[model samples]
Target: MNDSAIDYAAVFQALPGMVALLTPGLVIADVNEEFLRAAGRKREQVVGRLLFDVFPENPNDPAATGMRNLKASLQRVMATGERDAMALQRYDVEDPERPGHWQERYWSPCNAPVLDPGGEVVLLVHRVEEVTELIRARGGRSTGRAQGLEAELYSRARELQELNERLRRAHAREREVALALQEAMLPASRQVGNHRAAVRYRPAVGALNVCGDWYDLVDLVGGHRLGVSVGDVVGHGLAAAGVMGQLRSALSATSRVADGPAQALDVLGRYAHVVDGAESATAVTTFIDFDRHTITYSSAGHPPPVLVHPDGRVEFLDRATDPPLDARPDPIRRPEAGTAFTGGATLALYTDGLVERRREDIDTGLARLADSLRRHRAADPETLADAVLLELLPPGGATDDTALIIVRL
Candidate 1:
């Protein structure tokens, strides 16, 4: 038969497997009948469109890399002027009968450059073999030596699964013990001098272990003043909790001898430099004198405390003068800031977890916290703490450990 007289389109349609002719830019030029049937697409739907535009990688499947691999193969064919074969890929297609649904399809693809007489690639010829059935069949069948290998693989998988389960159980037990130890180290809420103090500590909901967030209230100068502290070590699990305990104890001891909040933080910074793994902790310490109606506070790389006034006005004491504990051998002494608390005023000291969120900025989270506090300013310390937590945390609960202390004067 004369080549010019032969029907090339008919021959291509009758060919086995799926085949398509694409431009150098990967635009679909022509597709065979088999390709159309395999993709559940008509010629009019795909002939003039980009390959990726017609069939995109499944948005729902994070593991899908078909589009990326196909593009790479096409580029390789164009660059080297040789055929490029790709391993099986899960290139899903849209289901025609079901909108917004996808059908998983696997293919073994090969791309070759169609060169012009001038030795330049004019088009790319892509051929695809549907390998989903073959893969499923091989996975389902086991014979002779294959049976032995399959059995060995199954046995190894079972052993590994059992080992993983045992590890999970062991981790659960450890977490429980760590949480109990953390709770034991925390101080209960009570009245210190003329101020009523309340505290709330919540562990991370999805965490398998505990964290270093903690709060404390200590009487200073023989009950003439009140010292309140909230701090967090820079990690999770037992090690962080141990650091938290040490910091809490050091803060309490330093407050007895130190003249003010700034001096206390300065001493703690010096002490943190000597302790192992205690350098990255953050804390805010405050001294309350009821007779003077004044509260002096200092921050060591921690979130500022929120003060609520009697008239329902809220303010954040955000003057931070030093880095986190142990950040330097001799950290600078943080400057102290003081504010007068009128009757019916409330003060809040909390770790960052109480006001930090993953998607939102720290300032935005702080604003939300301030708003919540203002709304519940008239409530008692315990009730106010509950209301603030309920507003900030999701129904599923917090993802990080949070420590909150509310003092009503």
Candidate 2:
């Protein structure tokens, strides 16, 4: 093509990343050569097919979530005519030659909308860069020496992949990690005074969103007390996770120095006002003082924690709950409430995913959660955590992120 007569098709192919052009309906209009090669699919096989139809979730891996997350990102772009940058995703691709085998792949995807003159989206630019090597690099930098080491590591890993993959397929541990990609971002299980603690994190079915929900447990007063919190950042995607991470970190730092949960949250509320994307986020923080035999709690527009008695009775810590973080123009002192607990009682802190459902009242969901806790109150902390999640979550999965922490108080 001459300088004045540019070939748009050639330009699309030369865009330097794995790019796919799709209609607003998600039908693939075209794919750049890089995308076709990286995905190990011919353009003829993918173009004109729906995005999911072209690259469906790997059936062999029950933990495969690429389709759902990508679908959610694309849908968001279509809905808002905005660009969406997805977190690193582990989406396996089927081996074209092998009938049922899959090749593990990871991608950093971004979806953008191409709008018409009327400002309506006419096309969606689904761009992705294969990051399989980078993730497999496992923290290799781009320095001169690091690049060579990364290449050597990549080569060595490739040589051992067949053996490693066989071992991975034989074990369920890898699957567990894949199922909770967001879980790895959260803190691992640790001791909290004399109490036994259990934590479970499940991302939304659609977004697989690191989904703005978070949970934390911090030792206070030299192990005499424990501070725990569950919060939601009011949005989805990487942006929400960034905001959530900052708020969680701030609360973690302040909880130790603050007098109580209310003071900690008060500090966080003011901090939230300055953090981008932190507006209207909600959280519930609690301090369990062993010496006092009491639990002090404060909520910022989040669901109240549930306390299950030795028998079957449940109590909602709702007295001190207030508006969400930064909901007020100026920060005010938050309210705090405390209640004594018996020896065999249980404490539950969870994000809305455990109780909020589509087309139903929140009270109804809370009631359901309470009933489950009541029945499982006799179980131990780990057992109780698993049971509550199993019983309360929908059979398919919750559409929102869930972060649950169970403590045998």
Candidate 3:
């Protein structure tokens, strides 16, 4: 589990098959014990030597093409940044005891490039499997058994490819199930009295990156009062989705009877402490009183709601900010803020994913959101929500899930 403690170099030495590490310049950089044993040389002798220098073609055997073929494969990998596999071929290793004599060896070799973070080829990994015994058993490659061996090798490669494909499909199915569960938990669209209300939810852009973000448009007991909330769980996938669903449901029910946003969140905070995997989650809740022209808001370590006015003004409802749910041991009352809104104004409550970029400042994201709201202040709630998503998220997609609620006041 701790990658920092892992000895990757040791792993390379213990890996099966004869593997040699070569720099892009074709210099021998490192080789496993298996490679050294196959070459009949020590690590010291072959590590700093050139590939051709370590095991040059047999001087006595004029037909020796091992070095030539291997050189071509390694060059291809370097040039194309792709893997090159060579078929069965004879490569002779010089005999240590016999001095001048060389031992004949047949091998199936593959050369693959290792790329750096920038995607340039940095090293080449040369892997080989010795099949001298199998080749000699039939006396030559022209025999039926040799042909059968080649067929078996092809069969093994195909089996590996199929297994990888099945695993890919299984992963895709799992992602679909996670996404379905999240979709089922989310509340569908509903009208807020006498106003244009829009809710949007975007899943993170990766397999199994769905869930953990949600929004709800609840119709409170009083038909004139509408409840809107957006929240984010601590993690992704099924467990976080379950926590998100429970928290969203609890708040939706509690807000109906509670006095204001603060009181409703007070109960939800306590409920969160008992819910598994619900700690440290963040959410923002607001009650839009269509009859009163007032908005009461509360946050659990969430970003403040954005209030955009028609006259190039944006107000952040941050007075009620508090630590995330279950952030402390004892239960405490959550803070709440209230503000009056004029007609044709908009209120936006969203999860952090709407603004936060990987390397940019959070304030910058908040400012961008404000600018977008102010720029599109005249647009309807639906158009404004879509505009914010397009303006803030990257072209590829957001790495984290986002939940957004836009209420036209």
The lDDT leader among the candidates is 2
lDDT of each residue in 1-409, candidate 3, tens digit only: 6999999999998988899999877789999999988878888888888888878888986545568667767766664566889866677888877887889777889889898764457988999988766544444545576678766754554464456456657867888888688677786555665688787888665427467887887777775888898888988777788898899999989999999898888888899999999978988899988788899999999999999977878999999999887786886888888999888889999999888765467998899999999999899888988999998865435667888888888
Backbone atom clashes (below 3 Å) for every candidate:
0, 0, 0
Query: Model 3, stretches more than 4 Å misplaced?
Result: 1-160
TM, every model: 0.64, 0.58, 0.62
lDDT of 2 at 130: 81
lDDT on C-alpha atoms for all candidate structures: 0.81, 0.82, 0.81
Candidate ordering by TM-score (highest first):
1, 3, 2
* Residues 1-409 of candidate 1: C-alpha lDDT, one tens digit per residue: 8999999889988878899999987899999989998888888999999999998888997656678768867876664566888866667888877868998676889888888764457899999998655433356476777667656654554464456456657877998898688768888889765667889987665444567888888888844688899998877778888888888999999998888999999999888888786868889999988788888899988999999999988878876556887777657767888888897899999887777765457988899899999999999899999999898764335557788999998
Per-residue lDDT of model 2, residues 192-228, tens digit only: 6567888988877655346699999988865588999
